[model samples]
Target: MSDARLANARWPDVKAALESGKPIVAILPCGATEAHGPHLPLGTDVIISESIAAFALPKLEERGIHVLVLPSLAYAPAEYAAGFAGTISISMDAALALVLDIARSLKKQGFAMLALVNSHFDPANVAVLRDASETIVREIGLKVAFPDFTRRKLAEKLTDEFKSGACHAGQFEGSLVLASRPELVDDDARLQLPPNSNSLVAAFAKGAKTFEEAGGPQAYFGTPAGASAEEGVASLDCMSDMIVQAIAAQLEP
Candidate 1:
């Protein structure tokens, strides 16, 4: 793997990368430190976001774009999972401040654009991120590329389960963990859970506040038993492509 991660790169390497005279885009992977059912780890979203950014790096390099992958942001508003143990649900305002502060600092650090690769699907989290992105772009003119998967078009590219509404900690999310950190997955328990066909989007539409009320009794939905490493790889490919495309549109336009 190339040393594209900003956290591990030396100051000289980072300075050189930033001054490469290309369209430099810093990758900020956002995830939530929340419970992901009985089988998956609490850092499932973090692992997935980092993995997607890693997968997208070499491709961006090939396109003559300098990439800087910041360490995954692990705190976000996950009010939907607040009732579950191990879920750290930050307030919406706090999340917005964190994102805005990061962007402000990055803008001053010589990077031209900030691409947020977020895998957490909680509405409150996404809302804060989207709002923050808009605010940053408006205030400092720093470009932000946020791939909104909640949209039907983008979600359709991932999988049937994703489009069917049982995405949280289900096959869609589990497959990502399986591909990136298989050792973290409890294969036995994951393979035993039945399919939970709850519609998280619809639940949110009805003003449901928690996953428990959204029909995710075990803090998960979707068909975990059917998750495959192959599916995870495919989904990551789609997600990375979306991020790359968003960046290209911003830089090229």
Candidate 2:
């Protein structure tokens, strides 16, 4: 099909692509409008997810899979960062319903697989995705894959500081944005900021309700000062691989 995104495509082109009789896959970039500390833009997760989808588009096509990159789903259950000026979180039920409805719509249009390329890391948001997508896997015939970076295999591929529990707008994410959207970063502010290594993961397990309770007063963790463009590109590759592996499994089966 055309290089245009599904959201921008004419219905005729979409139908032609669907009727091509190939393994049709729809890439949904799930992200959120939330706080990413002081140096990064609010669209960090959405930008990262969309960037990964763009990078993986040709790769998936080369592997003989017909692909459509959907517009980023820009809101999720981000209770962890609520009250942060720009953070907009949906209720858990609403988030799940949105994903389910969209997936059902794609399946109706003939997509065989729906891969969720999500980058929003709030435990609450991830939970909604895991629960909703899991139900779809069991109840629907359409294949659904969400490459949760928190999962062991994908987590291992990320940085040391990321594994430490505080990765919000830190090196891991900063490096990614630096690579894909340099204009969105404030280099001076990032380099001067000290690392906040508080483990939000630990805090969540302890029933922490907000960023401050999790020990991140400025809405961040890890070292944004150390982020580099090179690291960002490498991280992008890892995210792209997650999508490929998910689709490969269904093809093999």
**Per-candidate TM-score against the hidden true structure:** 0.97, 0.96
Q: Write the per-residue lDDT of candidate 1 for residues 1-253, one digit (tens) a residue.
A: 2587888888887777677776678899999999898999999999999999988887787787777898889999998898989999999999999889989998898888999999998988889988998999999789999988877778878798888877889999999999999999999999999988888888889888999998998999888999999999999998999988888788886
The digit string of per-residue lDDT tens for model 2 on 1-253 reads 5574888888888888888887778889989999999899989999999988887877787787778888888998887788789889899899999888888888788888888998998887888889878877787667887888899888888888778888889999999999999999999899999988888788888999998899888888888998999999998987898888877777776
- CA lDDT for candidate 1: 0.89
Count steric clashes of candidate 1: 0
Residue 140, candidate 1: alpha-carbon lDDT: 72
Worst 10 residues of 1 by lDDT: 15-24
Report how far off residue 191 is in candidate 1 (Å).
Answer: 0.9
What is the C-alpha RMSD, rounded to one decimal, of candidate 2?
1.2
Best candidate, lDDT-wise? Answer: 1
